[model samples]
Target: MNQQAEEILKFYERQGKPAGQEEILGALQELQQVLGCIPKEVQEETAKRLGVKPSFLSAFIKKYPGFKEVSAVHEIHVCTGPSCGSKDALKILRALEQESAQKERKEGISVKIVKGRCTRRCAKGPNIKVNGELCHHMTPEQAADLIRRL
Candidate 1:
């Protein structure tokens, strides 16, 4: 087993019960939390533990939002809700994308950008999240600045 799989199995072992078939989603989530991206071997082992085929677990990752094939050093999500969209959130997103050097990053900082919906802080329109850190009332310049730092 890989180091990440050992750590993930330890999480389930702590519960004093095997992760049931129904808990595959939970186990997959735990794996993602620990390893950033789920490895093929981890999926195979998880399928074995859940008494399912590896293909089934792959389907879950394909359809699930929390699962990812690749890990990013930083994630930037821009709000595109009614309020944020009205306040030029798209402009900020564009600026951040242009500044991130997404195509080729020799620096190894993989910055992922997403156009997200209401951040719950709708009143704080034009908000963006940098590596899960919420920045409210943002501007293109401010968003660009944050992206550059990544």
Candidate 2:
């Protein structure tokens, strides 16, 4: 085990078995502080040390909203499948990126864009979901407008 993993394991053992989400988050934050981003291997080791399933750790990480808030990163999920992409999804993404860049300068919001496949909304082709809200038939200009409004 690496030094970070060892430290995490020692911390977990000291805290006893079945640690809560807050404790897990605290450990993850500590690990990140010590070693930057949490590596998958370290996550697995941390899960093992805490006597929790790897999936449990992963789910916790996914559900933890603290990272984005603390890191000043805003996540935008854009669908880029045959349907959405064909409908100018790239244009929408570019527009959103530009808008985000402007917002970052004025409002200080750091936006991170993620391209998603399908999103199971092909029927709504040209669809984009901002933080999970499905916005269908969105043009590039509309997408830029939407991000600014958000």
Tell me the tens digit of each residue's lDDT in model 1 across 1-150: 457767766666554444554477777787777666776666677666666677877898889887875555688889998889999988998888887764213232467788975688988778888888889999999888886666
Which has the greatest TM-score?
A: 2
Candidate 1's displacement at residue 117, Å, is 2.5
**Stretch of 10 with least lDDT, candidate 1:** 101-110
| Per-residue lDDT of model 2, residues 1-150, tens digit only | 357657776977678677777778888878766654555566677788777888998787778654321224667788888888888999988999899887664443567788865678788778877776777878999988886876
Alpha-carbon error at 73 in model 1, in Å?
1.8
Please list the Cα RMSD from the true structure of every candidate, rounded to 1 decimal place. 11.1, 11.8
Off by over 4 Å in 1: 1-72, 102-106
